[model samples]
Target: MLPDTLDITAIRADFPILSREVNGHPFVYLDSGATSQKPRQVLDAERAFVENFTSAVHRGAHTVAGEATELFEDARARIARFVGVGADEIVWTSNATEGINLIAYGMSNASLGRGGQAAERFRLGAGDEIVVTEAEHHANLVPWQELAARTGATLRVIGLEDDGRLRLDEAAAIIGPRTKVVAFAHVSNVLGTVNPVSSLVDLAHAAGALVVLDACQSAPHLALNLGALDVDFAVFSGHKMLGPTGVGVLYGRAELLNALPPFLTGGSMITTVTLTETEYLPAPARFEAGTQRVSQAIGLAAAVDYLDAVGLGAIEAHEEALGGRLLDGLGAIPGVRVLGPTHGAERVGLASFVVDGIHSHDVGQFLDDRGIAVRVGHHCAQPVHRRFGVTATTRISTYLYNTADEVDAAVQAVADSRAFFGVDR
Candidate 1:
């Protein structure tokens, strides 16, 4: 199975916050699906860059500037390798939301005849459709909605099975002749269900549509290979993977990225500029406008290194076991309905559920009283909730540093909540 279990004690020690107490009890963080806790190494990496090599990248000719630029590019290369892609494929953004918007706006610009003949493939118009799934986060869904509104393109949705999995049989029918772009989550953030990426990719490809993968939920825990998946574009945030906020990644195939029109226009992205016209640089630089997130990029690189040293294979296996525990425990509780796939189905170490006769916020407060932190809301995936016929859900999401004890404690807290709230079996 896994190449020896991870050293849980040593891993917990890496996160200094784990030593702290909350509400007179030891803190148990299970909200990693929203954002993960950063380790000391990641914090130190960002601090080191800001303290020592702080300078404008690709702008100044000074020694510090050169060094800063070198480190920045080196970070890109390292992150690229971690995801099984080239440095040229990774474009840094404020977050995964921005990355998706960049591509959407870029396509909108192309539809307006911005990039000339090379960009014709990106153009969309009436009769063309953009497909997204019911499980997509608002970040992914809303952008495509805006794109459709802008380009006169129809927005199509692939319905989900009652179990929260994509309906592939219906998907084949939806991804047809007029489908220009097919976008779906690699793993649903709310349900914690891993989508069938290859099957969806095949359907989209057969229809001659571009594929965009929202990898925010998958990138942090799984070993990802965007090249192997053959998606034209993919995006993930660093904060969800033990790195700092304000930095995310957008991966696009080199050729398609070079051909797409730039979403933001300004310095560092252009090669030449006259009063009348300007020519932009290639791939990443073309998309990255204004001041870059230098220190944050350095921090994310450190996170990549940390994940690699621990082994993604081991991390995946660990999360799988934790997910199974979450499913079984939460399902056994009275009036608790666990969302997404049931036990024995593949899922990440995450579970979202609603308590009958109790509001999600009440459930969250009950758990917080016990020093157990969890997410309580629609989790930015309202469509998924709508599919499940609920307004809100309380979610527990684990990461590599989490232990089985924390999960059991959270489950017990949830079970006790119904009793505290006077909700009977």
Candidate 2:
């Protein structure tokens, strides 16, 4: 249950854009899976940083530089606390996509003999296996595929069950001694199914394979304890979590980050530079190449503060309530087919469904006409959509500011869409 301390009306008031009207109709924004709307507090945080301390972090010996650097590192500590990790365990990146790619390419570098003896554990050969699930976003899938192609390692996938959940039963069979890594989504963005991260972590660890979590969907909605999760690495985007764009996080076990080779090099990330060779700094700094996203980092820290203030438990209960209502309401609508777990299964606050005899584009447009914004397409998990025998789906995703009434409104729009497109059964 949402705690009394959290005033829903006040929380909604913090988001200035919630009052927006689309197509002259009351706007019902449901594309939070793509990017969450920022509250005024987050916006103010960024604005304050830019207005007061607009200087490059860790670059100069000026007063503003020191201020900027302090703010930047402070943000890191806050984010670290939010995710249950140490400051050094978190690496800053442009987004979670880059975070996953960093690991893949670093492993690629390791295979090509880059980080010396320390990186050998990351090395994979033709006989080695890289396990992923069909539910992975393209960001998670493509990088590993590229790594496999680069090193001659085979890319193996855990197929989806008919209910759109990962077939973890195959883990014991497929993830064997030769498996070097197992990467999977913590929560399905399209299907809304929250995957079993702990069990998957155990399975991967038992096989001596590193567990990588794509926590894009879970990090914002769920309480994430990456340390307790015992995963080798995890990545999530700031934009998806009521934070800024162009900033994301990569969390790794400290020792693994020490062992793993750095992906991007040069500038602030380096400890020493010579004409012939360069020595890189430790984990967080080494991964943060070039100028860092300082103000955005501050904004993200503010977002962390916002979520923390609301309490993750309350947020989860709120989302679960909304998700349950969405599933129930959408399931009852004629000609609607929800793509994930439908009955008595816990899921995140997103729902993807297809209308019978209608193109997903038409469905999206119909909803748009009603001032309802939804994501329509494979949603970067084409393999999962393929598993569902769907080329596309209309997705309605929720965030902390969303309400049960909003869910009902979105459902009504979806139901009316079938009639508008002449796809009603």
Candidate 3:
């Protein structure tokens, strides 16, 4: 039931991998929540750069270097605009994990008096608390844990409800004056539940704490405006959003980024080098140390351009329909328990579920035999699985290119798996 505005056939054609078969059956990729398939446009973009304008950005003073720098910065500007931010606010990292690590390490360095007086706001003492949620991916959770360990700051978690939504009531109580930072996911990778960003932002800001959003899941599926969201910082990966791997984005307010000390410092980020101390550059450059992800950044720009051409609004609408189908079909199966919101609640086009008497690995293998690819296990958010009283679950995540038939096929396969495992009863 895709919307009239979206053409599933034409869109699927853009991704070459979708046309391939597995186990002599039409390949049905339902693991977009883990990583999305790349389109030819993005591939071509990266290839075009590597073949022609491959050069060190902002280092060499030659024609190729100048063009490469322009293209790299232009990619930043385009990606920044895609998420409703200025070019200066975007900092490139290896991946979303690295982006979060950059912020954590930067804050840790600031606490250690690295950035001096300008970084005072980011400094945390022993009594200060860093709050995250039970729904956070390990990428978001582990860094804060390390940051807390390094700074002697306590790490707190906002719990989840029975249906996997964040406990906002508990959040309000937990995010008190002692909270220095509140980090959470925009969308839960396991549950596909969209968290209350505005409400959380209000709570964090009210307590005079900085907010960091993990936008890895939301950036690919929803229409995003980081500036309008008002979170102090955010991070997303290119690979999750139809772009190449080896490149990710960290968006911070210009003033905050400027004030924050550099996490990784070396060549391309320094102003002047003395025998004793080295002066650093400004916001984006200060954070992007070493050689840049020149071609990958260009590919990411092309990814955003493809998304723009197709329209995020239409994509959201299409996924909503697919989500309903998944919820309805999967929920109707015997011995199957779908996690997250119940039938009518809003969520992205993804579901993580456990089948009674069936191991998640078995279920995943069962689905794979039928040419359906899905994500299994804890999905890197162990606490969410622990919250649901399960150690593992199978997940199917959808995107713009997925269609009603693919979701239906996946649903049927799950039901078939229960019978295969002698758990149909």
Candidate 4:
């Protein structure tokens, strides 16, 4: 059973934004899938770093620089443990988009004979296949698309089933000898459908392909152990996990990262630079070029610490209960069609829906007027919306702080939206 201290009222108190009123109504933040509101601890961490020990890391020999470097690397180590990987395996990127691009660019370098043995492992050529799913966010999809274009490899995609789950039956036949890399999400950001990752990983490995998991949605809500999952690479953004923006984590097996060449080259990522030749730094340092987001990293480490204190398992259970409430309440509303699984069994707290005879933009605006925030549009997964026969959707995503009362408010707003727009039965 889940712990009783995960009470929503108490959890809500941790977030200051939840107390603020929007047009006299208490703010109901359901847009956590887009970006979560930070708790006081995370905010203070960032401020403390900027105020007390503001200095460039890994460069200066002075006291402040040494302190800053220690704090920065400590943050890296914390994030590494948070995702179940070695500290050296964690590459700090601007965001998950940059992280995915780093992998894609590394593969491109390998194809061009730039990377050594590591490059050979990732090299793609004619007849080699890279597999993705129709449900991928554009960050995951477009990078592979561009990689295929650059490497002269074929890009294949796993289609979704009628219920919006990734169709692994086709994947069995599609992932074959020519397949080089298999990339997909642990959970669909739009559909909220959790994929069978272990089974898919097995299939990909059996076919001699590497797996890259987009864990932007799952890492924030679920208990993720990348080492146990055994994927070659995994990427997630810090902002969605209650940390500041401009920071993200890319976890790769140490050997693979050590073998792959750096994506961005500059000051910090070099071992030695002669006038004529430059030798790069190893692993994480090689990937993290230029001035790192020092304070953001510190804040992200604090965010991980906060989540660990609350317990990810407890958070998941709380979200599942809220997901059940959301599914039931939204299902009963007229002119409302909830996408993905209508039940809570195979889902999390995120729900996407469409209203008959009313545009999603109108629905979003109506809900906002009632102090409810939801994501509306293609949600960066255009192909997924296309599969569901819609151009856009209104999505309500919950977090650890969300309550059953807020879920009810969201459902009521949806009903009110349809009625106000004259789409109600």
lDDT (0 to 1) per candidate: 0.94, 0.89, 0.94, 0.91
Give the least accurate 10-residue stretch of model 4, judged by summed lDDT: 1-10
Query: Candidate 3 regions off by >4 Å?
Result: none
Clashes within 3 Å, all models in order: 0, 0, 0, 0
Candidate 2 per-residue C-alpha lDDT over 29-93 given as tens digits, one digit per residue, 9 for 90 to 100: 88999999999999999999999999989888999999999999999999999999999999988
- Residue by residue across 271-381, what tens digits does model 3's lDDT show? 999999999999899998898898999999999999999999999999999999898999899889988887656579999999999999999999999999999999998
lDDT string, candidate 4, 169-258, tens digits: 899989999999999999999999889999899999999899999999999999999999999999999999999999999999988898
As for candidate 1, its clashing pairs are none
Q: What are the RMSD figures for all models against the true structure?
A: 1.3, 1.4, 0.8, 1.4
In model 2, what is the error at residue 258, expressed in angstroms? 1.7
Off by over 4 Å in 2: 1-6
Q: Is candidate 1 or candidate 4 better by lDDT?
A: 1
